[model samples]
Each structure stands twice: as C-alpha cells, then as structure tokens.
Target: MSKFRKKGKKSQPAVNTAALPDIVFMLLFFFMVTTVMRETSLKVVNKIPSATEVAKLEKKSLVSYIYIGKPIAALEDAFGSAPRIQLNDAFASKEDILLFVENEKLDRSEQERNKITWSLKVDKNTKMGIVTDVKQELRKADALKLNYSSKATDNIAN
Candidate 1:
C-alpha cells in the first residue's frame, strides 16, 4: 500500500448564474417602467426658422408645444398644402386652442398652472395670419405666457 495517496483531481465548481436571468428580467422591467416614449408624432413639415435671439424654456414640463406648418408631402393629399395647427397628435382649428389650453391647465397642478408656457413652433414659410389667429385664441384661453420656438443665430442688425 502506498503511504501517500495520490491527490484526486477536483473539478472547479461551476459559476452560479442561477440569478442571471432574474437580474436581466429585473433590468428589463426597470427600463420599461422608467422609459418615456414619444407622446406625439408630428404630421407636418416643421422647419423652424432661425432667429437672432432665442431663449430656451426654463421648465419644459410646464410648457405645451403647438406645431404650425404645412402638411408633409405624404399628408398633402389628405390635409392639403395649407398651414395647420397641431395640438398634441391631431390637427386642431383655432377654436380648439381654448379647449387645448384648458386641458393643459388641468394637466398641471393649481400652483404651476399660471407658470405654464405655450410654445408656438411656426414653420418659416407659414403666413402670419394663422399665427395671429392662434395668438388671439390663446388670449381667449388666457394662456398669456407664450414662447416662440426658433433656432439661435449670431448675426442680427438690431
């Protein structure tokens, strides 16, 4: 009998990845819950013109966007080439501005309602008539805090 027994080759223990799937699923669920997807799809050709001075909104959450532009090539057949007002995801007339403003106001708390800013994203080629009408409608809604969306530019005569 050999005095010293040969050492047995012990296989290394396999890594315990039993919780791997659970961890992956937990991460997936977390992203799904926290991810904020686009709420509205623009149906118009929004080409915001450049401006000499442009100021960014302080609180984006308190701002509601109104898109004004001609219909895109795809939508031209149905909506025509005329400029349209987009409230949320749908085309809205000036008449709808009042309701839209009211709805926006209702979405925010009473304390922050007054701070809500209505941003107008007017296309460059769009005429001023529609914009003026929108402004008047906003006035009726009493949403006086208005902001015009424009790209910043360096050169300005003023």
Candidate 2:
C-alpha cells in the first residue's frame, strides 16, 4: 500500500529489423543491374579514328575486340612507341591472331559461332600495315564478320 508498490510486468521495446535484410538485398540487386563491368583491362591506349559514316553494332555479345595502339606510358620502355596488337589483356603478336579467333569461337554456341564479329579498335595514329595484317589473319581463321570501331565525325567531306 506504499507509494512504490509492486508494479505489473513491463513490456520491453525492441527494434523491428524484420525488413532490414530485404532492403539490403534490394539495394544489392539494383546496383548489380545498373553496373557494367569491364571484361578486360586495356593494356594499350585506343584513340579510335573518326568516321563520317558509321554503323552501330546491335549484339555486343557476338563481338570480340582486337585493340591496336601504341603502348601506353607504362609500357613504352618494354614495347616501344610503335603500335602493337592486344588480345584480351596482354600484348600479342600477329601470329597469335588465328588461334585467338578459334578460341573465341569455341566460347559461343554452335549456331552463334558463324555470327561472331571481330571489332577492331585501332588507334588513329596506327600504321595501316598492322591493321591490314590483322585483317588477313582474321580472314585466315574464317572470322569473316568485321566491324571497325570508330568515333563519329562531324566533317562530311573526305
């Protein structure tokens, strides 16, 4: 009967974290859907040549990139300033072209193999001789479909 009598059992308040995990998962999926990861780290500099007339490629999955450019500052001492071929992430000789094409073809489905296109990302300053050699090697490997990656040019006159 005193002022401080025995009190009834008190309910403890708790933080409701039931939806926290769901929210975290949703954010993770949103980032995954929006992000585009680079397939390979380019070892060479690629300042693509410009062109007036150009076609945009529709299916990126069917395209394989062949980078041709002068060695970047870091690689200048080892590879020199001359333009060179890069397959995947490393510097490659023209002799390795056929084998590279064959290996890339093996990664596609049988029906899609014939549709694979080689996209040449050549530097503007690169000599035509190296580009021509790459084309010849690609032909030897039966990779007939080709695309030259270039920037759009405002100048219409050649």
Going through the candidates in the order shown, the clash numbers are 0, 0
**What C-alpha lDDT do the candidate models reach, one value each?**
0.91, 0.91
Q: Against the correct fold, how does model 2 do in TM-score?
A: 0.79
- Compose the digit string of candidate 1's lDDT tens values, residues 48-152: 887787887988789899999998899999989999999999999999999999999999999999999899999989999999999999998899988889889
Candidate 2 colliding pairs: none
Report the lDDT tens digits of candidate 2 across residue range 1-158: 55335433444579899999999999999999988799888878899878889988998889999999999999899989988999998899999999999999999999999999899999888889999999999988999999899888889465
CA lDDT for candidate 2: 0.91
lDDT of 2 at 93: 98
Could you tell me how far off, in angstroms, the CA of residue 36 lies in candidate 2 after the best superposition? Answer: 2.9
Off by over 4 Å in 1: 1-36, 156-158
TM-score of each: 0.76, 0.79
